[model samples]
Target chain A: MNMVVCIKQVPDSAQIRVHPVTNTIMRQGVPTIINPYDLHALEAAMALRDRLGGTVTVLTMGPPMAATALRKALGHGADRGILLSDRFFAGADTLATSYALTSAIQKIGESRPVDIVFTGKQTIDGDTAQVGPGIARRMGLNQLTYVSAIPTIDQEAGEITVHRRAEGGVQVLKTKLPCLITMLEATNVLRRGSLPDMLRAERAEVETWNAEAAGVEDIGKCGMKGSPTKVSKVFAPSPRAEKAKMVEGDTAEAKARVAIDALAETDPQLLSVIARQPALAS
Target chain B: KSKELPEHLKAYKNVWVFVELEHGRVHPVSWELLTEGRKLAAALNVDLAGVVLGPSGEGTDSAVAEAFHYGADRVYLVEDPLLENYRTDPFTKAMTDLVNTHKPEVLLLGASTLGRDLAGAVATTLATGLTADCTELAIDPNRNMAATRPTFGGSLLCTIMTQQARPQMATVRPRVMAMGEPDRSRSGEVVRERLDMVEEDIVTKVLDFIPDADSNQAQLAFADIVVAGGLGLQKPENIKLVKDLAAVLGAEYGCSRPLIQKGWMTADRQIGQTGKTIRPRLYIAAGISGAIQHRVGSEGADQILAINIDPNAPIFDFAHHGIVGDALEILPALTEAFRQRLAVDRLAG
Candidate 1:
């Protein structure tokens, strides 16, 4: 039961600061971390490997510096690490991103067929949740997204049952192996790597693959050229001219009443909604 | 199919908003889009059109009439019972067919669960660019659709443009746009279009429409005053602090999307990108880190007072007021303060 988890290096959103002059995010000094959601997916993969007695390979696509993120993955108990880095892969949108990743996964599969591939439901930056499905489509693998729990995996039988979060409720679905699973957050807690694991991760040699090396031939469809969507512009939300009408109430109680009155004046339904809740009011 | 400028659709000249209807009732986001569409139309100096696809019935006709009141200059009514329940395949076909026949410069759809799903498929089918979860939209001087949304989780904003694409498309989150004033006297021309597409060709089936539970309905989109919490609350149980404050102020309660991801609360109570957009009068953000994703969702609030231990938190950058304090201590203090003030006000009144 060999599992491969694909993770991304994302700027610590908490530490990101906007450049006041250029109106661009200041990315120079911000330290990158494994996308918070991908951590859960990595943990899920590692836990499965631990339980089923198999190898876990961590894969990432980014600049050369992204090796740091892969090392972090290795420190978390992955048996192997692979970095898919190339200038051609830069500025790739979800479509091209999935293409490059799927190509690398195929090259990896040449050595040992990957039983499962794991990714977060979406990246914090892209927030599209489309890459996982895109990869599944490109590789002809079963796509399971918004997965909350993996109940069982029958390796020989090539079957897996998972609890998938649908629009309104959970759908307990079953699918064959060799599938891509995007785990929802909080599905599993991440484990801290031991000192020995950190030492090994620090010393381990990570394999890097360029576009041609990863078996990608169509350079046009491999990066920005393959991406159909383009971002034209981004700007700050315009501020409204009118300031908030602060109530005249002096005390907290007075302010509360004023707030309630103001809210009721605007929409009485708000009061009804609150009154309906017993715990809300004394 | 991927080629440019179908001879038939060359003359369509305006922006259109697809008014999504469910259970014979129009979604409120449609009206909201009308207000937004009206602005873009004026900017482009073109007519704003509402394209409603459904069966020919009173509901459909009423929606057309309602569209005029909301500022649409004309309504394109596609009458077909097959369109009653939203199946992605049929809806996409119906919409694309209309676009191909009557070329609109821009298309706006609500970024609802259904809208996102349909927009992606339709944009791919048309091979046109589409932006999702747009918090703002404007027709540039060049007549391109400029869709603005937060990037990197709302730490910064980015505006996306679909260059050289006909029928430029964008999906806006619910409540991010204001609803237009209803004018009962206003009327618009309604052109009924024929839907030749059949239901059998559709691949997905509408198993059921599980309406939201009464208790679970936060109505955050319609909330006037929202008090939301975030991971800063430390413990999931501290969410009750926000609930208590909301209870006193007669406001709805919501949390940042991380709280939902953390399983601290259900999706209904979550507020942010991928959660809910709220335009409340007074928003009390307790312990919220104000990530760009969450900021985009709540930035529309009229008054935002951020309470967090870290004054330097991003929440304060946009917050109208800020208090560097522990939310746990501040929440109870604020709640008790509100309780007493409100009691005194009721007596005075």
Candidate 2:
């Protein structure tokens, strides 16, 4: 089985800072990490490869610096890393992104047909769980999104069963191979790299593919030209006239009393929830 | 604007909202999407239509009727046995084929799991633009639908517009939009369609559905009083303080996104842009740094009480009331005080 896992490099949110005056994200010096959700996908893929006897290839579409992300994956037992980087892929929205990724995956399959494709439920930067389904649609693969568990897979039979997270429950579904899965975050923990894999990550060369080399047949469909959605304006949410009033007290108990008193004046409904009494006093 | 489209694209005529019917019940977000669809359609002077697709008896008929009650001028119905369950292949094909047949100027769906799954597939199949998790939608002066959503990890909001795409597409955040009163007397025309695909062609099958136990699921989104702790609580064990306070007040307790990432809390208990958008009457946030992402989800609360060790924490900026103190200590103190106060109030009253 050949499994391809899609990952992205996103700014570490914990380290992200907002501008004091402008209230916009100050991203200049922030370091990037492989998207947290993607780690679950990578782990799921690697776990399957470990059990099912196959290779796990980590793939990413980003700038040249994105090779660092692939190396991170390689450090975590990935058999290979492929970077799809090109100026033509810049400013691509979900549609063009899926197309570009599908093109690269197809090219990868030229050597060995991919049995399963994996992606995180969504990227923190975009928070749009569209690209995975988009890729599945373009590649004619069955889409299993928000998958929590892959209980069974029969490689020769080309059959698989998964537990998918729906709105209110888990849908235990059976599907065929050559499918795309968007792994839900927190379903599995990423493994720490072994010493051998960690050393290999430093020495291994990541294969970087440009648009043409990645078999992008149409240049127009790779970037902004292919993306119909355009960002018209970016702005900060307007703040209220006054900031939160500092409720102060000499002690924590006083502070709680003051805050509670203030909340009573502002939202009596909430106050009643806590202290509402029956008509027993009457 | 519809007139300017080339001959092939000119048929796109009305605004369509996908009514999410699953397991014989309608998601609250479906009604919310229709609420916004009405406004968008009125702004563009187009009909507000609902696309309700499911099995014949499993809430499909009721969904069609409710669509009109929720302000849909017409309802497009597609009932098939294969549609009883939401399989990506059949749902996407049916939705895409319908969109191609009856061109809609703007299409909206809830950003729920099912809606996102189907919308992404259909939008890609149709080769159109789709803005996900939109918090705002409006009509541009050029008559295109302008969709606004949080971007750059929720620090900034961006307005997206589909240029030259016949049917502008967007998925709205579930609780952001206000749902209006439904008029029971409302009636509308129903357009019927069929899912031509068959089970034999489908690659996936639903073997069974296991519902999450209600006792385990957190009802944080609709909680009237919510108390959530953040990283300032130091570690997972300290979460007990938050629970103690919530227990006293009989409130649902949640945590920030980082806790979920850290495995300290379940995903359902997270309050942030990526998690549930809570509309509680009063929300008490403890030790939270108040990232813009967290702010987006909690800002809708009628009143916010923030407690943090750092006076400059951004949570204080938007919170209605602030206490610059350690939540670890303050939470326990607040709990004790509130307990005594309630007891005293009850005895006096």
Which ranges of candidate 2 are over 4 A from the true structure?
A14-27, A251-253, A268-282, B1-7, B214-216, B234-240, B261-264, B326-349
Docking class of 1: incorrect
lDDT of 1 at B117: 51
TM values, all candidates: 0.74, 0.92
Q: Rate the local accuracy (lDDT) of all candidates.
A: 0.76, 0.89
Note the clash tally of each candidate: 16, 0
* Model 1 per-residue lDDT at A184: 86
What value does the lDDT take at residue B107 in candidate 2?
91
DockQ of the candidate models in sequence? 0.19, 0.54
Error of 1 at B65 (Å): 7.9
lDDT of 1 at A77: 76
TM-score for the A chain of candidate 1: 0.90
